[model samples]
Target: MTEMATIMDCPPPGWEPLVEELARRVSPATVIHCHEPLAKRTTLRVGGPAEVYVEPASEADLAEVVKFVAERAVDLFVLGRGSNLLVRDGGIRGVVICLAHPSFSMVEITGERMRCGAGAKLKLVAVEAKRAGLSGVEFLEGIPGSVGGALRMNAGAMGAWSFAVVESVRIMDYAGRIHERPVAEVPVEYRACPLLKNHIALGAVFKCNATTREEVAQRMNSFSVKRWDSQPAAPSAGCSFKNPATIPAGRLVQELGLKGHRVGGAMVSLEHGNFIVNDGCATAKDVLDLMTLIQARAKTERGIELHPEVEIVGVD
Candidate 1:
């Protein structure tokens, strides 16, 4: 078989033509894997395959894929480091684009400023900033996703939100148009960035005050210790429920005696009530079922409705 054939072969059912066309459209350096299993891509380690998975070589290459998907009107999902996400059992129907290329993971620091690419892991950003003696980003050390995902969700950890450190973000809209916006002009809430709801976050520029490297390291270490003590070590999509303003989600779960609840191989972590962990052999269905039980129990028994904090994607 030809090299191209290997990359484009055996697409799930009707996905072959689309994958073939997409492979032809993007640059040769761009990686396209048809019928790629997504379980390995996600932190939860559950879910089926993506009909087409793409890793673009550059921003131009990513624009090509986005343009193609927009023209085709097929569903498009952008994958970061795949934390805080759950892909359903039947898999994603259309194309899933991952910004895993080196072009999208670069992190550079100049004095007290840091510029990060979308695919750069949150942990890496913190480490780099810490190395540069920047203090504000130490909170990001405990977040488990990529900068793009963090921007999208306004992800918070240790009382600091992603946008709090961001001076501006470079975004690519679904129409394949790229633009940069300052944080003051962008709208963000507790856990949502409205500007990124339909657009892609390519990267951001972070402005932080100068601090001693020793201080940054000390802060990161304290946050890490607290996270390890509070959160579970098992494979999970992070927090499963958004804390209602009236109370913290974990506290509510604990109060409701739902911390150790299990359904199939999916269990609410005894370590953190807000997390649902896969018991090695758990399926996406198991996780979803357990999540539903938690929500229902929270609503019926406690008079509070729990909503998912993790992004649930793809078909059931």
Candidate 2:
């Protein structure tokens, strides 16, 4: 609570009025008390308590919360499913907004397109697409994390990335302005995108061609087997490093003899070098050190720069 005690106790000029402002606009049930472990909310199941966590019931409530932070000049974080996040032992400051409400979890399939809110899980997207006889999203069947996080990280596997099927997206800015933009308007790179600043994604429309439901399920089954064989299913961020254009990060780490390397309680997965898993008990610093080790080894051996795919948030 050092972060909160230092910044939130006395009420700074720009952030002090947040509580009253947010309360005026939303129901009390949406707000959670202090000391709730955020680790339970994430796939990794690690980290400290959130000083204040708010789960708005609807999009209107979400908009009001965003506006409240803006009016008070306080910082706000938009969280999806928390699947790929690494929250530090020190809790986050200001407000953390969870957008997994039913209103933000809608999914609609029309023609060959699927429109899904940011909170929708990737697994759900794959299942819905399969039921609708869509072929493209089958590759994402085993990918854990929300659609928003997938778009943010350009999450991909089985020769397809999330952006490959995205037709357009809706975003909400810090000041509560909403904009709908086509895929062409947002530039995408390998595991990165031009949609990195200002706005938070609200939902997206993905264009998928038609296929038989059985074919889609079969494709998804193949992906699931691959994931189960290669990844540590315990508690981990999906992949620790982004693959280079030509070589997979896992392959590079294995080539450098860095697989199974350990730091504190974190170790590079022996099965998949691109993953760092908590063997027993691990701190954020343990994971950080392991990442650096693999990066340095790969650079010295193959001359390729390694970039993190996992989103590292909060204090180090």
Candidate 3:
């Protein structure tokens, strides 16, 4: 049977007891669910459930969750708006904490600096910057996902990266201890911030320049138009592969004659070769199979090694 037709909806074995234990430990306001379906939470809209999904109501609640996971050596996944992600069919094994409560999504401006809670939406940050007559984050308006994801990925668009505007970041370690570090102290390398992988992003402060609202609007509009013209409107986990230094990944896919290529319900978008879109009935395996096909073709036909840009997680 196809993966989509045969996938089970059960939480992992022992998840019930673990969830019961966790529920007793966390704040009452914290939203918790057992065997929470994660498909709807992602941009691709195709994945299994999180064995135990949680949305902490406050920083203290988040810390408590982290502490509980650490003490038991439980696997933990931090979900941030689920943009560039692909969860496998079996679902996650342990805890999935989403920092999406009101306290984590607040935004504040002070002089030339802006503080954004990790859960704050990128689009919202851009809008706030524009409201404050700022210019640095206009590029962020085009990117989907939260500040935490942007910080973790160092997300960039329109010639600017997430770290380029970052002044400092506040992070909580696995042990639930919080620390503040300057951007200079936090090392980042192309679409990755390694520290955030092991730590939870609480918030970040960004540096921006004073600018007229009209100028910011113009730039944002230009970027929006370009993105709309170039990207697909279908459901995708953004770009499938990272751009090779010599050529963009999309152009490479086209060069390989794989644009609009299909493997079951997953297809390379004709609008953008780098995007593998779900055609209403795609499963995680379909997308993965299509990726393998693309990789094989690119390697044999063009001697190119295409690596995925989207983060693939969960079990097989």
**Residue 292, model 1: Cα distance from true site in angstroms:** 1.2
**Backbone clash count for every predicted candidate, in the order shown:** 0, 0, 0
- Candidate 2 has its poorest 10 consecutive residues by lDDT at 1-10
The stretch of ten residues in a row with the least summed lDDT in candidate 1 is 1-10
Local accuracy of candidate 2 as per-residue lDDT tens digits, 1-316: 1112112233324534455456557754455344446777777666775655677766666778788878766667666677778878775666788777777788899999999998899899999999998989887788888888788878788889989999999988776678899999999887766574567788899999998999988888988898789888667887888789879889988888888889988888888988888765887778888888888877888889998888877765
- Expressed as tens digits, the lDDT of each residue in 1-316 for candidate 1 is 3233235557777767777777777778899887788999999999988888899988887888899999999888888888988999888878899999889999998888899999999999999988888989898998889999999999998888888989999999888889999999999998899888789899999999898999999999999999999999999999998999898999998988988888888998999999999989999999999888888888898899888999999888
Model 2 Cα shift for residue 242 (angstroms): 1.7
Error of 2 at 204 (Å): 1.2
Q: What's model 3's TM-score?
A: 0.95
> By TM-score, how accurate is candidate 2?
0.88
Residue pairs whose backbone atoms clash in candidate 1: none
The model with the greater TM-score, 1 or 2, is 1
* Model 3 lDDT on a 0 to 1 scale: 0.90
What do the candidate models score in CA lDDT, each in turn? 0.89, 0.78, 0.90
Residue pairs in collision within model 3: none
